[model samples]
Target: MKNTLLLLFSLFFYTMSLNAQFQKATAPVADKKEHWRNIHDDKVLDNYYWMYDYFGKGPDSTKVVDYLKAENAYLDATMSETKAFQTDLFTEMKARIKEKDESVPVFKNGYYYYSRTEDGKQYYKYCRKKGTLDAKEEILLDVDQLAEGHSYYAATGFEVSEDNKLMAYGVDLVSRRQYIIYVKNLETGEILKDAILNTEGDPCWANDNKTIFYTSKNPVTLLSEKIQRHTLGTEPSTDVLVYEEKDKSNYIGVGKSKNNKYIFIVSNATMSSEWRMIDASKPNDSFRMFQPRMKDVLYDVTPLADKFLIRTNKDGAKNFKLMECPLGKTEAANWKEVIPVRKDVLLQGVEEFKDFIVINERKDGLVKLRIRSLKDKAEHYLDFGEPAYAANFGANPEYNSTNLRYSYTSLTTPSSVYDYQMVTKVKTLKKQQEVLGGYNSTDYVTERLYATAKDGTKVPISLVYKKGIKKDGNAPLLLYGYGSYGASMDASFTSTRLSLLNRGFVYAIAHIRGGQEMGRQWYEDGKLMKKINTFTDFIDCGKFLVAEKYTSTKHLYAMGGSAGGLLMGAVANMAPDLWHGIIAQVPFVDVVNTMLDESIPLTTNEFDEWGNPKNKDAYFYMKSYSPYENVEKKKYPNMLVTTGLHDSQVQYFEPSKWVAKLRDMKTDQNILLLHTNMEYGHGGASGRFDYLKDVALNFAFLFTLEGISK
Candidate 1:
């Protein structure tokens, strides 16, 4: 009898502990408030629209907070089994980082400027040395100290005056990207009383150290609306409004020429651009129009000693071209071709120097640097020797220097900095990323493959995996994509991704349309009326991977954030059986609703990318593919959707509302989870290590689904 009682007690305690660890908690059921949106002769009923009421402090604000908290609680309970695994993953990933790291110093204006991170610190210290690298270091700003108390803090736009006596920087405590400008007396180590609020972070200093030009943003919409000039130690309210952009769709910014001879205010939209310039010596002078905005044409101006270089898509140059215009005759008609547009090559941009120009061009989805001597027009392309890599011009602030600093990296290689002697054609590697716990590029293999799209267009896919992984259709693969805004999703190195690669996971990046990987035309085909192409292209890539025996449908996963999150949602709906799991971070899933609401941040600015839904044709087209709108009583892949409460780019309500609808409509019992960071914004945690926690959770989710605990 005693043995029987002891056995029963042991069993009872074991059951209790298991229940406590993984509780069968009920998922939060959001209250459905009837909300009807009628537009373009179409009416739609939204049940979770109350989520949008949080920012406005409406009656449902408390409900919104409560629902998000409840969802977080549910996620915690559901992922309880992986709590220890998550901590282990975080520590493992963090261990690979070199805690004490410093960036390569770049020479500019008699000072070598660089940033260094201390051990265990989440931010960096901006510093510079006068004359030489061995000179006593002058710490301009200690961001780790500045970000000490705030839960979310960002510092940007560090600019030093010509004399280097003063430094100006921008700070944002709220994480909304609305930065306040502050000046510091570098000699005295005192922060000035000048605080310019609600301005874009970058401050362009005039030749006169006291005057600074900045772009002021609208408080509500957070759009760059006006260029304002501020005199240090003066009241911000009394700052002079240098220029106000009347076009709501255009974004405006203020910048100074690299030679420190001109100050410019540039206004640009999706398809058009205009520039205004004034002499940097004359801060109070009116800016002259360098060029007027034109429809369907985009141009950028780069100043040189004798003339200005114009990079434009004028005359239907879909791949863009470089032209030269005399300083006095700054007009479209006066521009003459310097680098003619090529059918195969896309002239991305040009870096101007005293006697040479380095042209950034792309062909066949790879970057090529073309160096040309300004005196003799002798040009040569630099050899990178990599099949798939990203190389771009790094800080070449000194226009007279023959050495150009650039960064290079690939899917399997660590990011490396190099100084290329443009005249001698010599390249010297300065610094490479230190992946602490020892890493070798030869331990991995990277391949560039092409997948045929529905329209027969070839989409590039960059894949990296452990050296021994076989294409046996049994290994798991995580394919990522972000096909929007002509942003090329290049294959770059991330030390943290080794955690996945080592676990027999094949990681790949689908360079689908909507990105400029192939060229500008690739982006054009994936946006607006052709927006459906982006979705189809992603599906085709996944299908190709499965067809090629890289992975089976049961072990394939997909991940994307923001606009890419929209891609996740679209794929989950369009091809539900293709992916075993999906992770959408702060996804823009509510397309028609978000685009129709002009009051939302970035809505007006995205009119060209996502057509204005007020139009009848665009509304129906976007509605047809909108993730939230197309939610049906069907099975969806296991999903983990994340969002930030104060997300300014893609509002938190989007993902919140999306998860609620999926919970209500999705038929599968697959694990569907939402994790909302109540204190942060669209960018998640602001710390260097804090963001890794999020990554750990994501990785843990993937691992748990694969039945791998550690």
Candidate 2:
């Protein structure tokens, strides 16, 4: 009887231990809600005094107002101090890296170039070469002046004629609904003609240089149609209907051949694509579709003189293989493998010259430029051992045959432009950029950690901090991620993040599923019906951080924007206890509603990524985790939700409705701030300084929650 009593006592102890673990994971939600309420109430009183002091009148204002302002200022100062203290503590524990490098890449040119400003401004800068690796800039056009009448000045590709007489560039003024093909005189820099075209098209230079070929929407169905031979001085001509995409699934575009005999137009509907050959000799000739018999083929085809190089996944491998086929005779059976797929490597693009073809490939996360001899099939690889993410190789305009330039960059590294000689295989560094002051990469380190998810899947988490940091639970941890659309969240340097790091916070990237980090299969597994894996993986990462004592739940903050915002929404809803605060910018929270309506823009195109909600199973799956639909009566953490009024992708209404729903359903009176930019598109904060301010506010909120200063 005594032994039995001892056995019962052992069982009771085990159950208590499990319960304690559960409570430890969930105790932060109540504490966070209480803290947020206190902060919000105090801030309200502080804001009242600040407003009264700024606008109040009379001679006695100096006396009473000064006292009130001083008291208010004290509170504000205390909040700021609290944030700083928390930041410093995190910095001490995590060894935060917040150094900026002076050497980076800058655009060097003499002409005024139009580019997008951080504050959603269409600004033009006159680029002048100062010396080798140095350039001067002057403002040419201000977006604020032009942004009044027009929504935005979206700049696309620009092309100048061989004689430098005329220049042409494409611009999508608003939401890609109206595209304008603008032609300009190079000498005067005045727009000669701004021809409006349908959505989904790019301008292609004709052989005659005076005329251009492009595609646009059909007036009847408003579907994509091909238009050719539109000259500068002629009247509006009839569009040659190359390929009519019946369903909304197909995409159409025109490509000019090197020989200029046949115009290659591709039609892609769903995952499969068909190349149609159009006879340039006869403008009215019918287009014949060249269908290839390959399963799961994904490619972008570029034409050469005699043969066309196809950048595609024709082989049963993860990477793309370059296949060579004769022009106008490219069929499934006619394709000959020119470059075989290497393990853990992908060939990106190919640029052909007279005797050789230059192929860009990524091996072991590093980019290499390979030259393949067309005559002897010999391959020569150029070794550029840098953490380069994306690269573009261009032949010099002065000596197109001899000199080539390649531009590359990584996360921590700025862009570098190098000029290479094909014959000599020697590279000359042309330019390096200087970003800003007070940043150094050597002071910090970036490391990858794998954590087990709810399903035992290993999720890769990237941590960036100062060296020799202790594994303490006191650090203010900011975890960021975007897990969707097979997009890999590559490591890249950011100047704005230095402010948070310097304040003593631990920054992390959780590479959950729905991204292409592990491979294509990883993305496929996480998307569609398996989308719950993304939220679970992120939660697992948070749990692992707490379990390892890297950070506590009370000091952890989560962030995501755009599609990543969707990630933020899901995770916040699933495990609000694990996060002190969340920042969701332009999130797609109404997934079931958005995907169900085919009338919405780009809805059909995304059906492959997120399954069609018409099916009952898909509807159930999407509705189950939809953030807007799943706001149960529960205490939510402090959240800052932002969106742009001009955002075309995830419309502002989604966030507006989401904030409303969250406010209605939330039990705790937590601060749910919704900041909407009136002029910006999907990206908020148009200016660099404005962006910095927004980031500072976000960090300030997180720091306040950690009780750093107070």
Candidate 3:
């Protein structure tokens, strides 16, 4: 016992020595400007606004790049002490993955399609077999070959023609989300001469198979604003503009119906949607409007036998409901209710087939699939035994089949895919993701808990930890939250997270407002003017857990990315002393400024999700909560901020300027580091295993603060 105490004492001294050495190195400094602006009779100063460079290679980009490089160097110098440990973490996490695994084949038309990863490849190979999975594998496109010479690569909108002879795909070589559409003659193994640039990545195929409808992005704002028609043999410059969205706030998209009977163009904003339909057989015919756009009336059209199924939010159905209309009369007044809305149920979406209809609904913050037999109209819900889990429809391309494919997972369960007979109600497990190393689902435990907010509202929290770990406040905990855009962060299992659980770390997600966890009202109560509730809810969750002996402030850590990154920034400012460290990834910190600038990608389209800062009330309200605008000269916890230079969603300038200002005004000597990925964008690295390197880096930062460095 004496020797053990001496060993721990010696290790603590060594760690302290490393911290002292790191603190001596000079931190990167940024030049500040006295730029003042007036808005709604208010004056504000933005010192680091000079970092705004959309292209990342503008005339002033040199200084911007240099400052970023210096920050990267400082991070390297400070984190150098954990270089070996980070590498080991990366290797450890990567080993849990099955390197040569293949996804379960999804059957479409005459082929069974799937993607396979090679033992050492960085990208996947899309392959298919005709008739059955036992047939010879036919490679559609080797993404590994396409990504060979690029630093970043992503392929999207992978769709096959109705005839199964052509593959339409989109590629983005630079980590920006701008994808260029391409068509390949699969039989000849040759890419065609057609190439359309800057698309939203979803291609709609006409029944003729030679004509395609795709949405194009605006050059300046990067919003999907135009729908274009391209024939297989036509010149790229001669593509016809079929439709265009004049409203800047509306995003446009095109899709083929599930039955491949009709093509559609949908224009949607936050609370409104308008759809136009085209007969699939007549490729040259113009599309006709199914419904006119109405404010606060959202709906989606699904092609049915003699009528159209519309999932709409009309008639005060805040949680949405299903309605039907004649094929020739799709106007709102002519619609008939197919499924009534329930206050406690959130009707997410629907999948139509000749023999069955699947409704995806959320209740009590959990997802379930309701399968109804079209013949007898008998409905049944799939049972997931866990208190919290995710279940939804998989790719069921055929409209005449009785077998339904679905996926299910939870915090402790591996992703499992099954094919169930809707009529017989028999389910067969097709595949479950394999973890290479020895793993057991029963080894960990997940629980559902609620934390009461200041307003007396109960916020749900999903927690997972190693089995048999004592809830004694001594264990380190990582809390995560992202509450924006009505996006629900479901309880999904991940193999990489096992690394933390095995090392005595508890992970929890605070499902706060601004997400659709508890239905439409949950999201309604936490956005725009009520955005503070999302942040405060997360804070309350942390306080509740600590008070309950789950963890204390000394060992608590916070993490989030993008809008959630905004959450991290808010919590840090609101309760700086509550966390030992915080990691913000590609955070949208400059909310007020970013919203005021309409040229940015998020400004025009998300004006409803966020408010239009041009309004005086919104200007002052957002100004009060914007993270970058509210940074004060006070002590803060250790922070590690990361962003990519080529980010298309939240610009790199946001986080870059944020960290610079924090360094200038922060009073604490606590370690603050910024990492700028020069080769990636908003989503980070494109390689299969390369993104794990960042995860390992983040874990290393947390482990170091807890003095767990090896």
Candidate 4:
């Protein structure tokens, strides 16, 4: 016992010596190479522009790599003290999840399809049962086995042929979002030779079973530019180019109707959409244009038995409305309003069934599922019974069935799946996420609060904490925000979040603008020239939390990813003192520079969302808040910035350059760590359990700042 104590004491001293060495180590200093650009008479200088040379394999490629490695090494040395804590957090969070779990099976076609994970596995196996739920199980794809040797592997677009004899799926080993479609003979258990590369990973199978359609992407820009149709057993080079999008700004894809009667080629931009349709049975026939692209009218067609239902923002329907047209008359002039535009409700989408239709509506930042009878036009909504919860349609593939599968969850409730009878209004709980190690909803408390923005707009904030926790200023709180692309940040439940709640941390989600939570106008008011509202909304929420005694400025932490990372960068620049620490994951921080480069992936496609910077007005507006451009010599909060080496959406150089500049300029000697995953992309690790490690590191960063060590 005395020797054990002596050994522990020696180990402690060794660790302390390493910590002291890391503290004395110098941070990596990025070289300053002058690069200037002038747009609309505005000239600017960029010192870190050379970081973008990595992808081009230019002279500075090795230098960029060496610099990134140095920063990573610096981060390792600085955070070496928290290494064991991060692993402990990972194990703690992973323990709450069921090792072997299966999804609730969904009845589709002639089989009940589901995916199940195995013990100690990082991926799942796709399985199905014939006819009845008790029938013999057939394994379609064992993703675990397929991903065995690959460091990063993603299998998506699982499209089974209408006959159920074959399956077509896309695989991405590079983690760049570019997938290669492969065909597998499910009945014979044989993999086919048909492989198509550089696709968007969306494989749409035609009714004939011998043909498939997929959207092809540009190799360099990674833009979905062409829809190609390939025949079974034929070389991919011989694939027919069915449709090619001329407008670089519009993103295009090919899909089939849920009823399997028609194949569609959809081209959509931020403000407009166009669609073309061809009979699924007639794969060789030319596609007929249902509607030509309009200036600002965005619409989508849902095929009904006798007519086509068009959900559109036509005729100034800001919140959108449902319009119907006769089977043969699909022109805009022939369309008649079935559901009028509501000022309070936003018609998010619709799911079509033979006898009924489900309308997904959002009002007051909450999702509402309204069932309408196609035969009688009667309508009713499914009750979720929670003020701040996320409810949405699940996998309801059978167009002839009356049952609607929907999922519901709140900040406190576990994700629950339910199948509701549209005719009888009866709902059956299919499954709720099994949080291993036990979890009780009553032990937690959730609240939906509104924080007034600087412009007087009421931004919604959803928060959750332990039941016994007091609303005092001493608690540590993490405020998460993602206000971009009209994607609503709903209050959803995750078992891993319990770790934070159990650790006396309050978690809050800021439903800021640039999202369609409130309404379409809410999004319009927060994007383009008004993009400042998103940053200010997040800052206001942080301040509001402090004012309400949920947390104080000293304990407040902020986190965001992708576009939300842009938010993190903005808020840090605009209001640094509001947060003690910040986490920006795969952040789109170099906005003006990224927007000006059309060759970059997603740059040309997001012109309407972020604005085209070539124009004089937009050039100035974007530069004003562009994180990397606006960074100045000032005190800033401790920040942990993460990026993937091969991120297709937002390049890794953005975060790398941003961090280098922050290190060079920031006055405060706060922790500024940059973690670049050398093997992953925008969405980090592909394995189910592997992502938890990153989460653990993030939580450890926050815990270290809060001085909470386990």
Candidate 5:
């Protein structure tokens, strides 16, 4: 009897211990179905490959959704302590925003167009007034009504007819970016029955005002391949296909010239571009090729009074230059230099007026606009006061107007619109965003600094902090980056970011490689086999900031989305101890898998950006740094991974699989969360105020790690 009692006691204690462990479980251990993939004599065993099952389609999708749900629940339960704090943060952030606001009205054609938000509305009400600003407003569409029944909503590509009676718009509710074009009679206030399905959302209005041209995408790959012509009130099924881009690697788009003289069909690849032109006055006419596609030559045509201006990289002009050719004689040999190529400056684009032309250029990773007189070819640049700022052309629909409308912003200033007279050089500030609850730009300090990379490249960093914040090493710092597609990360002000700054946090933007911050060569040096530089540059920036006493590893945090999320993952594996916490939004971590699958969106067109995995060398190189394949038994930072079920660009599975892999391998006990928004996409929440909820949740995660309850 004594032996039996002893055995029973031992069993009961064992059961109690198991229950305790279960109650304190940190994360779900994903089941492993290890699958072998051998490419170019290299091999990988993907354990969570089954997680790629389509969200709601396949038989295994239920398992996938359940697993994701469990992760969300785990995140919720773990962070339950911060729920109240999250609400407070959201409230504070929203309070700083002006509830009732209207955008600066832009005069175009015969009307002044603008959008306004009501005190409690989730979407904008698009309106316009004819003849004068004092005229009665014509509400074209109340977007909130269109967005009422959908969990996700977007209304874009609003183009008013030349006669100013009808407006064409595109609507997307699924978040997959497949938009349906709809036309409305602005004068009659009637929503037309005509609809065009599955377009790229941008439609070009012909001079006749009765027809529009739009590009369509392939169903599987989602590549814009065909341009179709649609006449108002006609069946979309009977629309004419104007042009088709036969090459899968090339993308096609249609637009009207600024002067509305020509409708252009632009076909562009990684290294080349071709333009087709048709007279806007003749909607029934076929397009004629302006210049045949050439290897290593990319150019865009802008129709001027009697000639066409071309921005081209011809004759080894890595940083493009401006060239001009007679309208009827647009051959390679007929091209004449208008603005000669400068090695140190990148000529971004040109905006033409009747008497002058505004050149958008970048120098030292900063944007400036140069106005040149068309009569005498004299030029001057617009003077922006700050060290790091962005100034670019806004809506200038009138080709003959002397006043140029542009937007300017910096790390310390709110977004401001200005009208600059090209001849007088007078800049009139039209409007500056209003930050409610008594905000002041003077309370912030902005600085521009550089971090040297391993290869002697100086990467720029933009820093902004609240006044009176110490530069001590103990201050918390948030480093943000996104370096891909030659997209530059500008130093723009954000009212939401004030939350972090007010909390004594320093925010820095690392203008790493893979971005065109320093021009084309900068982007070239960070792609393909040299792609590792992007990761190294970010890592070096973090280390340099720490060495400079900006912040230490204890309080350092990193954030990025999409391609930059890939950067976060690589750095986490390469330097796990460097960050205390990391936030990855809609990360594209499964590079090798996604690139190998041609059916995926953006894969076929981005072969030059990220090498084709079919090639032996490319496969091995990509496999070397692909985040999911690189995760090993290591200690990682506290991480919050977010994704949207309807994401069109970076599929939710990439991040889902990555988090599962990290959870299974990482040895750290730090928090790991996965928040899948079932209704949103690559860009988070659609509504202006609802998106702050995400920012609040992220802030709450960081605060929770620091034991901050407020």
Candidate 6:
């Protein structure tokens, strides 16, 4: 026995010596850069496997945990070195905008207006009476001093009566579900009459201006019903059911004809929408379906003397085309196509003028306006090259008899309102939103680039940064993106982003799939079974930025909200090494669980967007990418997960349970902070300043992660 024990001891000692020697040999030669590259490549291969493999048979929990720990370590180190970079960025931004005034909305002369002030507390001048700074600023309504009950409550859809006697506004304070239609006496500042109506849909005023027609949904029946002829100064005299939509989709009241003869309604049941016309004169009448077989249809109908002017997608192209339809017709087939659809161009804003229809078209990313005469075959087109978006035709009050007004903006431009005379063919700028005094657009440059995804699909990315910025590879990058639904992330100007861009750090927007950046087809390529593409696309974007030496993986941070948050969570799991830090605000991370249950509100409608998980196919697909379900032992990066306790859209429990699960599974001791706002909803912040401060905090965290600042 003694001989055997001695032999075993000798063997153990020999084994220990060999292990120490092996550690010494491997430790110094690890080559962290090469090691990280191999790990990332392995993760990419694993992600492809996870996409196709059966949900129940996936990566082991231990493997996931190790990856997350590695990710956390990488982020922590990167954040430590770049703390000063972000501080410089924010400091420079504040210095640039120190002298500029903030802008606010004001209500005056029975119309809602805006005011800009160098200081936030004082109003400088009214928007309409700009250039007359010496004139005392007029106060139309003292919103703060108004009685609590009688005060306007979060008005959104504002419309003034024709005679300007009544101010009709929609308010929703308690719940976003219901909207209160309040008609107030403009002269007396008294609540003339208010009705609790369906706030989920838009509200329209009747031609007479005395009656209001709106759409509401009955929760019990789960049907969208129309409430017509709710007269002012009295209770609803008619409870006319214009149409009852049986599909569990949204139905909205567009508007009534100028003559108040017909009411137009649009119903989106699933991927497609249909337009219907109802005779307002016949209260008990059923709606006449205009285009039942139209796919991806969007139209704005305006009443004309004999025929109705219509803008629709009847043309085989993706852009809208102007057409004319006989009002008393029985079928949409009777409509005459006035403007043919063009293959390369997209018709945007359309409005009816005295004798012509003004149409805006998008050609090669530039916006041009064209006016077509209804009486003659004459057409006039105007080009304003600034990458204009969200163009709307507004009638000029001064030249209301002949000309129209157009408002548009781009990346560097603030909103500009322009008046165009149809008869004179001249355009004049009426008003331009001025950025606070010291802020300048010339300091930053905007560029568009494409990142190649795993499947070789080119994803568009918009980068905004200070000109002549160093390409040190250590520069901080805050990448933002949303890859869900058919929502398009468009190019628009933001004063708030100035706070980041001015700070030397680069800010980028990744236009991934699942968004309508390219079109509906693009969205479909990234949803459902293709959901993994969205996460992979984001990871590829980060990799591309690093590969191009624009920013190192250490200084790279990512952020997204709502559906975008879901993107952040998925990418965090798949390639945590690519990001130093992540911010997910009001995320829908608990996909499989939330989608499987129908009892949750808005579940039925969302099922069409995100497939019903009860089905075997959907269960496999959803479980594959569900962040909460896929959580395993991993080294996750420093993550700040935010949620609103009152968020009715994405339940608060999702983030709560997700954080708890992540805490249990994570192997690394990385910071995983959960900030829940008790008062806010899906937005997470309440007031404007409060939202800005929250944004600052997020930027602070990101900059800190990039070693920019504490």
Largest lDDT belongs to which candidate? Answer: 4
Candidate 5, residues 1-710, lDDT tens digits: the string is 99999999995674343223122436777888877888777788888888778742666787888888888888787777677888999999999888889998888898899999988778999999988999999899999787887778899999988888888999988888888999999878888887888998998889898999999988768899899999988899999999999887788899888888999999998778999999999988999989999998999998889899999998899989999999999988899998888888988999988888889999999998989898998888888989998778898989989999999999888899999988788989999988888888899889999999998989999999988877789888999998887889999988889888888889999999999999988888888888899999999999999999999997899999999999999889888899988999899899999999888787888888889999988888888889998999989988999998878899888999999999888897677889998788988878889999999999887766554556
Task: Report every candidate's CA lDDT.
Answer: 0.91, 0.62, 0.89, 0.93, 0.88, 0.62
TM-score of each: 0.97, 0.74, 0.97, 0.97, 0.95, 0.75
| Model 3 steric clash pairs | none
lDDT of 3 by residue, 134-156 (tens): 89999998999999889898998
- List clash counts for every candidate, in order: 0, 24, 0, 0, 0, 20
Candidate 5 CA-lDDT value:
0.88
Give residue 120's error in model 2 in angstroms: 15
Q: Compose the digit string of candidate 4's lDDT tens values, residues 402-423.
A: 9999999999888999999998
Superposition-based RMSD of candidate 6 using all C-alpha atoms, in angstroms: 11.2
User: Worst ten-residue run, lDDT, model 3?
Assistant: 15-24
**Candidates sorted by lDDT, descending order?**
4, 1, 3, 5, 6, 2
The TM-score of candidate 4 is: 0.97
**Which ranges of candidate 3 are over 4 A from the true structure?**
1-24, 54-59
The sequence of per-residue lDDT tens digits that candidate 6 reaches over residues 1-710 is 99999999995674343223111111011111111112212221112112111112344434333333443343334333333544554444444343444333322333435544443321133232223434444443333333244311244555555566665666555433455667767568687646646544346665466766676755532245454546666664344556666656444455655445677777764455667777655534566777673554556666666787776665444555777777677345776787777656666656665576677665543456788876786897876654334355654322124566777665666666787778788888876666664657788777778899989888888787888877879787888889887666666676767766766778887888887566445677888778888889889999998888789876788999989989888988988878878999889988866675555446666766678776768877887888877888988977887776546667666765576567667887455666666455676432223355456557766644443443
Candidate 2 vs candidate 5: the lDDT winner is 5
Candidate 6, residue 86: lDDT? 41
Model 4 scores worst on lDDT over the 10 consecutive residues at: 15-24
